[model samples]
Target: MNELFTRIVSGVIYAAAIILALWSGKLATNILFIIFGLICLFELQNLLNFKNYVSYFVFPIALIFFNYFNVNDEITFLFIIACLFVKLLLLRDLFSLKGRNAFRQKKHLITLMYIVPSMVFLTLIPKLYPDYNTYILLYVFILMWINDSFAFLIGKHFGKQKLFAKISPKKTVEGFLAGFTFTIIGGILISYFNQTLSFYNWVVVGILVSVFGNLGDLVQSKFKRKALVKDSGKIMPGHGGVFDRMDSIIFSSTFVFGFLFVINHVS
Candidate 1:
């Protein structure tokens, strides 16, 4: 009971912070995410056993460069490509018995590639339209929250078959399906209310976010397994750490931004 109360309190506080940051506009959002990205990097550094602290310095610089410099679309495209490639490799490593051993030698590069660019793309999401629209980014997060919430609630009460027993023993197939279903519904409702995107596009976005978000959770779980730690850190009492909270968004951001970017250009 106390655990549940703690989770609820921390979760509300975290959500409030994000909402306020988003509502405040560009600079506030960037500052909030930069702080989040740094915390995530710190947790990931511990998970990956990073001894060097260069990433602590490199993260904000890279984020600021990509975010504020008004770099051309070509550069952004290349950066997205690089993030996708590295993420795909991480996905492959997630399922492999060897795990992330292959990339252990390039720890710093992997750290920079994995965390920094994803956050950059996430911020770019709001700017995908002609103007900076916070609604789109907020909706993306809304769908993620919906998916995650249903996954947990449904999983806890009715979960039977394990989704990834080796990596995340608690996750069930039933939970994933529930999350996916509700996310699509949430997308449709958001479309009705916000009209940021067409119904079809929002549906597609829901699918992408749900599928990738869950995968992100799994990926983080694999990292925790490798690190032999239960939670990423003690930052959030019941929720673990900032990385623990942001893993789904971190993993899904690139794909969501890419999809929106392509559609925005094509449309």
Candidate 2:
């Protein structure tokens, strides 16, 4: 079928980009991040109707974070918090609109708040784990992939209990538990082989990813529902869009970056 072929082509493109960014240094990685950030931002703006001011701020902020100069994790974290404060202050009047229009206009920025920073985190992975960043990133991606793939296959075959029927009907409790299990197994297996990461750390990594990744998925799902759109974009065939594709990785990558940062510093 055309749909199946489209999905295959899209998958190949997606995989190639991810691998390229992962293997490449911070500069190349940030290039990819900026591109993705722009794409996601545009989609959010169109889909959710964010104000121009918010988009204006997020654009330059994302650039600064991706810069070579912004390598410090602490600085980046503070920058993210500062952005939140800016949003709170700048949008106070909009927030007080007390009607659907305000939230509607702000929805785009809200989504950017999560999407942009996560992309930066992806860019930061290389910076934080300078020596073994690629391998560590590999570990994170593998677990996320395993979690999603297994969840979809297992859930389709035997998905009885809806995990969040209100938000994502296709998701089921059985699928989620299966995803959690596979993520743990994948994490341990990958991290053990790498030697740079410990087994206990891998376990914690697995737990954090499963928790955060699903939350990210749910967050996107809520956004999609609120925005009244099924897919974020039409670029990918079966994947829907960038956000649709990177939904889980967004949160998982951030967690992995932070986790490795702590470990890399402590050890």
Candidate 3:
């Protein structure tokens, strides 16, 4: 009973904050996400048992550069490539059944490649889109939320086949399909009201969030399994921590941002 209440309260608060930030304007959006990124970093460091104080100094400096500077496509592409490489390493580590020492050894690399770049891309989404189009960033969050919510509901009731039993035993293929289906419905609705992005683009966004967002969740679960911990932190009553809550967005936002980049610049 208490757990159920906690979940409801936390969900309401989280949803409110996200919606408020999205509607408030660009500065609010940027500041909210930046704070979120920092908290996620702190949680990630703790989860991995990394204790480097230098990250405190380096994160802001790097964010300032990426946020303020006129970074070109070449540099952005390089960052993406680095992020992908780190992602591969993370996947390898997740499945290896190795000891925690591997993560400890590569702590700095993970911080630099995985944590930093994901946050950077998340922060960039609002800035990269035109002023009128910042809502597109909000749309990404909405889709992710919808995907998560439906996945949980459908999975809880009907899930049978484990999606990734080793990493996340609770997840099911049925839940994944339900999430994807609802995300498409949500995307179509958003397109109807906004029209900032074409219906096709919105459909693409739905696919990215449904697929990659779930991947993000599994990846975080893998990290927790490696650490042999249940939740990342106890910051929220029901939600584990900033890292736990933001994992999906952290993973999927980069891909969504990449799509936006291609649409706005390359194509």
Candidate 4:
């Protein structure tokens, strides 16, 4: 009961902070992410046991360049492509037997290419449409939170068949489906209220969030398993670390940004 209370309090505070930042406007959101990105890097650095000091610089630089400045669409597209490629590679590594070994070899590259850009793209999501609407980003986080909450609750009570016992023993197939189903529902509801995206697009976003968000959590679990650590950090009382909390969003942001971009520009 005490542990559950701690989780609820900490989760509420964390969500409040993010909502405040989003409502505060672009600079606040960017600053919040920079701090978050740095903390995530620090946590991952400990996990990977890499001593490269330069890894810290990659995130702020890339984030400021890609976001603060008005870079051409061509350049932005190329950068997004690079980040997507590395993200897919990370996804592929998750399924391989030698995943840890592969991650160990490319720790610095992963930091630069994967971890940094993912967070950067998250900030860009709200700006995908004309004018910077915080509601879009807020809704994204809400969907993720819903998915996560349902996954945990349903997994703990009704879970039977393990989704991946090796990496995350607690996760189950039932939980995953529950999270996905509810996320689509969340997307529909948000679409009616927000009008940022049509019902169909929001549903697509919900599917992306549910699928990739779970994969993100699994990937982070894989990282922790490789590091032999139970949690990323003790920053949040109940929630492991900033990385632990943001893992799903961080991993899924790029894909969400890409989809938004295509809808905004191509469609």
Of the candidates shown, which would achieve the greatest TM-score relative to the real structure? 4
Supply candidate 3's per-residue lDDT for 18.
73
In model 1, how large is the Cα lDDT of residue 49? 87
Residue pairs with colliding backbones in model 3 are none
Which digits, one per residue and each the tens of the lDDT, describe model 1 over residues 16-89? 89899889988888899889998898899899888657777877887788767888888888988999988898
Q: Rank order by TM-score, top first?
A: 4, 1, 3, 2
- Residues 3-114 of candidate 2: C-alpha lDDT, one tens digit per residue: 7788778977987897887687555666676777777776656666554457546765766646546456577667556544433432343334444443355554465565
> Lowest summed-lDDT stretch of 10 residues in model 4?
96-105
lDDT of 4 by residue, 1-267 (tens): 999999999999999999999999988999999999999998988888876678678778888887778888888688789988887877888887763455778887787777788888898887776777888999999999999999999989999999999889999999999999999999999999988799999999999999999999998998899899999999998999999999999889888888888888877
Q: Given candidate 1, what's the lDDT at residue 13? A: 92
- The predictions' CA RMSDs to the true structure, in order, are 1.4, 4.7, 2.1, 1.3
* Runs off by more than 4 Å, candidate 3: 95-104
**Clashing residue pairs in candidate 2 (N, C-alpha, C atoms within 3 angstroms):** none
Query: Candidate 2 vs candidate 3: which has greater TM-score?
Result: 3
Give candidate 3's error at residue 78 in angstroms. 1.4
**Cα lDDT computed for each candidate against the true fold:** 0.89, 0.71, 0.82, 0.88
lDDT tens digits, residues 137-219, model 3? Answer: 77888899999999999999999989999889999999999999999999999999878788999999899989889988988
Q: What is the lDDT of residue 30 in candidate 1?
A: 88
Model 1 lDDT, residue 260, Cα: 91
Of candidates 4 and 1, the better by lDDT: 1
Which regions of candidate 1 deviate over 4 angstroms?
Answer: 97-100
